[model samples]
Target: MSSFDAEALERAAKAARELESSKHVKAAVELSKREQNVKVREYDARKAEASADAEKAKAAQIQIAAEERRKTIAFERKAKEELMSRQQQMERQRMREQDQLSRQREQDMLEAKKQADMERDARRLQMEQQIQEERLEGARRRAEAERANIRARAMAEAEGRILEQRKNEDIHARDIQRRSEAKAAELRGAIQEAFSQLSSTLGSYIKDSTALRNTVFVGTALAVGVYGVREGSRVIGRVVERRLLTPALVRETSRTAGTFGLRQRMKRALGMLPAEEVGLDGIVLEDKLSSRIVETASATTNTRRNGAPFRHMLFYGPPGTGKTMVAKRLARTSGLDYAVMSGGDIGPLGKDGVTELHKLLDWGETSKRGLLLFIDEADAFLSSRSRSAMSEDHRNALNALLYRTGEASRSLMLVLATNRPGDLDAAVTDRVDDAVLFGLPDAAGREALVRVYFEKFVVRAGEDAPRRLMGLLPAARASKIEIGEGFTDEYFAELAARTAGFSGRAISKLMLGVQGAVYGRGEPTLTLEIMEDVVQRKLAEFDERRRLAKTDYTDSASEAVTGTAADAAARRSSA
Candidate 1:
């Protein structure tokens, strides 16, 4: 065992130790490897879990990204669709605007055409109216020219006719004048022969009783013959000339003519005469006469500063009153030239009437002698427009008369006689300076007038004859007698008393009627029987006229009263 064994043991022991240490190290290593392996396994497990989670997160991210992409695409698509819709709406709006513009243009063109057509129609109508007016004006002008030609022809024809009539009248007048002159010359020769014979007879008578008686007788006879011849010649000359030969003869003729003419003209113009002119003795205007008129005229004349004396008078009265006779007397007393005019002569007063009146007035004014302008029935010219129912022409004539009367400044007298004073206008009355109111004659006036009439008709009887006749008949009966010679103052007085309320005109008519009755009986002188018969007839006529006038007056009064009563009743009712 020794040393070798010890060595081997040691070796073995060492080997054993080594072997144990190897086992321990191997076990430790194995344990350490197991622990490490466990740690690694845990790490691997954690890693694996982490890796799974990471993978999940990545998957979620991918899903989210895809959703975002889808959303973006959807948004882009909507925007594009909206843009297209806007474009379509804009295009529709443009189309509507264009359509409205076209309609407006068409309406404007139609209105312009209508206005042009109306203007053309108006112009055409105006032209037609102008042409019609021109034609009417031309027609009127032609008518006026034709009327002027007709008037000229009528004037020429009228003048020719007037000239022919004048020529005929002139020839007749000249022939009458020549015949008168020849007769006058013959009368002168006869007068001269008679004078020569008278001178010889006177020479033969010279001294001695017997011879003286013979010579005286012869000379006386010769003287008578000469006187007779001269008287005969004058009578013949007057008849030939149709006028009195000398101034004295002419004056006598004029006096006689005036009485007859005045009576007739006055009766015709005024329808009446004064009692004096009719030969009835009565006072038409008692006491006063023409005093008022004379005074008024005198006053007017006195007021005149210069020119000739004014003696014109106008007498206006009712029918049967004296006007013309008074004028004639006035003309005779005043020594004025007298001319008579009838109102009827002025009726045809165109230019001719006016000219004649002017000429007559001028002649009167310019004459050396005082002229009397006597106009009968003056109311015919001076009548009121309302009363006369005058035409415009008549009124114009009256105006002319008024002008001449008012402006007259000459020594001419005018006497205007009228029956109707009421019919004269105020202007006419004012222009006249004097007016005489002539009324019906009273008993005394009528008697005086009758006497005047008797003097002209009956030859005057001797004083003894009138008394003798008065005794033979009753006083009233004898007075009514229409003596051929004019009545005496006493005879007219008795007749005037019997005929009460009789106008001067009626009295004169009665006288004429009495004369007619006497003449019918073939009696030379008027008798009482004739007078009575005539008076009875006239009285009956007068009574009838009065009755009719009274009846008319009564009826008119009744009507007026009834009208007044009815008017009063109506007025009361209205109130």
Candidate 2:
């Protein structure tokens, strides 16, 4: 276009060229400006969009923070409500506890007041009692004072009567004395006249030889007579001794002749045979003690002490504890003659007791195999000189016994049995080589005693059958008892334990009682129930006896009086 417009260009070329250049420049500038403006607008749009995004993010963050704060506040509020609810419950509980404490305190105060009232009442009653007692005492004192005054008046009257009686007796004595002196002077004058006549007659007789011959004859006769009298006295002594001391034939009231050795001879005559003698084997002593005793017996038999076959033994215990039985058994076992005497009886005989003791010792010495002298109830007479009532006779008898005991004789093995050995003289105890305590049958001893007694007691086929206590096991097993139950060993043992205080004698008596009951009832067997009844009665009786024995009558009287007084006072107070 420019080429074509060359002619036209000549005319307007400069104008065109300038105009075109200007236009081009303008377009370039415009283009440049548009591009710059577009860039700036895009930058402004991006900035606005970023600013909006920032604003939205800030709004979201604020919402989130507000949500968190709301949740924390809600949680804190819930916790505060819970804390307040717990506090309220605790406050209510505290109030309830305080109310309970208040009630408790009130109850305590009420109880304290109640106890105080009771104590006050008791104190008041005690004070009243004391005051009443004091009043009674004062009345008693007044009565005693009045009685004393009356007694004084009576004593003065009695003294005056005694003095008047003495004066009358003195006057009567003087009158009698004067009369007696006159009689004496008359009697003396008569005696002097008779004596002068006898002297004159004697002088006449002395001048004769016939008188001298008569005197010689009389002297010779008197000497012979004196010799005969002394010889007669010796014969009488021998006869008395043989009859009383040397153990002669003693005629009983039935005229039956029996050897009179000692008082215990009667017992010996009825004692069991030597072969049948009961040893410790059949007894219910402790194994240690029984065995020791059995062993001692055996050993003594095989041994000898100081040339004697055995030594002295003492059996001390309660009565009926088999002491005598043991002693007899010892004698049998030791091959010695058993002789016994009651020291208690000796106490009653006085001087005769000494003679009896000497006789016993002499008799024992004469035994071929030796003798075992058992003095039962020895403490009765052999009590200490200081501890017991002593008289000249008793002392002499005790001395005789001591002398006899002291002389060691191979023939004498003296055994003393006493319930109270402590009461025995020290000298008597000193002679005891061995001492054994026969304590009340323990469980074992009781059991043994029961068996022994039962074994001996023959169980009859019928209660009506003649009752014999010698029933042995053979007889028992031989005849089936028609009774409800025969005695069992176990039952007997138990009965023994139940009969705690029963001695061998008591047990024997109990069995006898049972036998009596059975005999009356006509029962065949000794039933446990029957035995139980018997034991109950026996124990009750035993307790009563013990109480009575220990009770002092004076003390009982005082107690009765006091009790009566107190009861009367109480009755009066109640009225």
Please give the clash total of every predicted structure, in order: 24, 4
- Model 1 lDDT at residue 10: 88
Among all candidates shown, the one with the greatest lDDT: 2
Model 2, 194-244: lDDT tens per residue? 999999988888888898789889999999999999999999986556434
At residue 199, give the lDDT of candidate 1: 68
Please provide, for model 1 over 382-440, each residue's C-alpha lDDT reduced to its tens digit, 9 standing for 90 to 100. 78767646767677767777788763446566777876655667666554555566666
Q: Model 2: which ten-residue window has the lowest total lDDT?
A: 248-257
For each candidate in turn, the TM-score is: 0.40, 0.47
Where does model 1 exceed 4 Å of error?
1-285, 290-312, 386-388, 458-494, 545-575
Model 2 gets an lDDT of 0.69
